[model samples]
Target: MKKYPKYKSSGISWLGDIPEHWEVRRNKYIFQERNEKSVKGTEELLTVSQYTGITKRKDKVLGENKLLTNASSLEGYKTVHKNDLVINIMLAWNGSLGISPYHGITSPAYSVFSIRNKNENFSNFFHYTFRTKIYHSIFKTVSTGVIDSRLRLYPDDFFKLTTLLPPLQEQIQIARFLDWKVGQINKFIKTKKHILELLKEQKQVIINDVVTGKIDVRTGKPYPKYKASAVEWLGDIPEEWEVLPIKRLSKAVKTGSTPPGADDKYYSSEGINWFTPGDFSDETELRNSKRQLSALGVSAVNIFPPKTVYMNGIGSIGKVGICLDSASCNQQINAIITNEKISPYYLLYCIKSAKQFIISFGKFTTLPIINQEETKSLIFPVPSKDGQKVIVSYIQEKTEATDRAISRIEREIELIKEYKERLIADVVTGILAIRGVEVPEVIEDIEEELPEDEPEEIENKEGVE
Candidate 1:
């Protein structure tokens, strides 16, 4: 990282100082808002995201949680062209804005703009600069809303903001330099992620083997006497183990419900912790949720006690977690109150080990779904209380080292991501100069480096904690 010989105050305070040769200009002078509205709206639909920037709607394979579909009629949608910058008015503060690589139609809720002087500037440079952490905070300050989620960055406010104006050639070079560096970083991350996935698969195998009685936890050897489990999934289990349907092992098997309407009053920041299928991940404990329900909302749903095991009944079928405290869940989840016959931890592992088998029970519709009756009918291999304890301990002891390795690699990925963000902030803001730095002739997708087609893919690739 190098700096120019001279520097000058930006006078904007938050902007601090910049290279003496650079100029600070209002966005209005640099960008002209495109107000063209489409009559037919037959062009490809476009979307902007904090992770992926601008993308064609069809490019993303969305999940049930955040499905994107076309409106009844595409009429009146805003028209976008290549090199145009699109901003989701309500989410601009969260970095949901980007320069489109394709000509398309976007939602009217977004504001579209194009650079006024293409020869003297580059949209890609601003795309990189604006997405930096500092700009996210700046957008938050300028956006107007009653709450954080509702904040909007309208054309007028966005145009009023000031930005650094690097020389045309410098802008291109800086963007090019960043593209090369980020690609190298992303490549390293991909490799680390592959290793992490293998570790997870290995752990899953261990859990599946012990919980299914495929392995004897007591002597670390095969069980002497194996019996036909009768259940096809549990072919041959220890003679002492029994195959029992979930309904037989639990006091109750209950499904959750959503409230009547979409009223915001039904939800609160300090409300009851409400779990959903999305809340269950690789972790065993279901501690918190993305959204909570107010008392009124809670009235419409059933709350299960702590230690209750939750299994996904829809969407991501078979994913499981246990509540660390009393919690209410949505319709997508099934809560099981295990009787003295089954330990919650053992039941949790049982559900996890039988994920693929449980998934098979789901009716393959537009999205896989399993109802309460089906969930209650799913069978598992059960052992006595003492046996269950031994299996649980065995799993903990066997997977502890693998879990630690996974955590270490995850933290390494997080640190690298943080470093990448900091590097972008410094370089784009002129804290580091790339004037004489040579950029490779060939660079990968510049703006397309971060965002992936699926949200889950992005989580596995760039997200780990």
Candidate 2:
């Protein structure tokens, strides 16, 4: 990382100074808002992300969550061409804007703009610049909304912002240098993520074996007498254990709902803990939520008691957690308030072990879903209350070391991502010059490569809408 030979004031306070030869121009001079509507709803659908830039909507890995459809959605979608800048207007302040490398139709809600004077400017260079933290802050200042999530970056405001222009060759060189470096960094991230997956699998195996009686947690020895659990997935359990449907072990089994309407008054900064599938992770206990509901909102949804076992019933079906406190959830989750017959921790472990079985019920659906009836009917091997406690404690003690290791690895991945963001901002803003950097030839994964055909012709005739 090296600095430019000379620098000058950018006139833009946030930008401070830039390379002497670079030009500062209003975005109106650099980009024109694209208003082309898809004549036929046959183009590939695209989505913008803060993390990965522009990507095919279908290619996004949203766990088992598939995009739910609406009637004739792509019919009036905005058409985007290769290199056009696409912004998720509502999320522009969060860096949800990027240069599209594919020709596709995006949501009518998004704003699409084409680069002006393409021969003199490079889209990739500005793509890097616009997505930087500095620009995100700038977007926040100009965006119009009462709250952060609702902030919108309309076309007029975007056109008024000043942008930097580097020499065309230098822009190309910087973009190439970043492409190579980012590819290398991504490969490292992929490896780290794979390790995380393996660690999770290892923890799952331990839970699966202990909860299913494959491993005797009590005496660390084989059970003296074993009996067939009758349930196909349960296999066998200790002779004293009973295989019971969740409905029999819980006093109540029901679902929660979102409050009607999108009004801000329905939500509050200090409202009820409202859990959603998005709040879940690789943790047994569910606590904090990203959004909270007001007292009025609480009246619209069911409030389950503390220690209730909540299992995701739609999209990412089968993911389970026990509420650490009284909480409310959306309709996509089934709340099972257990009775004296079962230990909440043991129920959590059993449900975690049975995830694959629960998931199998929805494998053929467009979106994975297991309604309340289906969830209540699902069976689990249950032991005596005291026995369940012993097993839960044993499992927790055994998995403590593995959990610590997972946390450390997760932190490392977070730091690496932060570093990548900082590097992109520095290089794009001319703070760290890549003018003479010799970018190495990097071979990206086959999946990451763009199609060889003309982008506009790369169509998905049967669109999701």
Q: Which number leads on lDDT?
A: 1
| TM-score for all models, in order of appearance | 0.80, 0.84
Residues 197-229 of candidate 2: C-alpha lDDT, one tens digit per residue: 898898999888878887788677778889998
- TM-score of candidate 2 relative to the true fold: 0.84
Candidate 1 lDDT, 368-408, residue by residue in tens: 57888998898999989999999999999899999889889
Worst 10 residues of 1 by lDDT: 456-465
Candidate 1 Cα misplacement greater than 4 A, ranges? 36-42, 62-76, 219-281, 286-304, 310-319, 323-337, 356-379, 445-465
Worst lDDT run of 10 residues, candidate 2, spans 453-462
Cα RMSD (Å) per model?
Answer: 5.3, 5.2
Highest TM-score against the true fold, candidate: 2
- In candidate 1 the C-alpha lDDT for residue 175 amounts to 82
- Model 1, 75: alpha-carbon shift in Å? 5.1
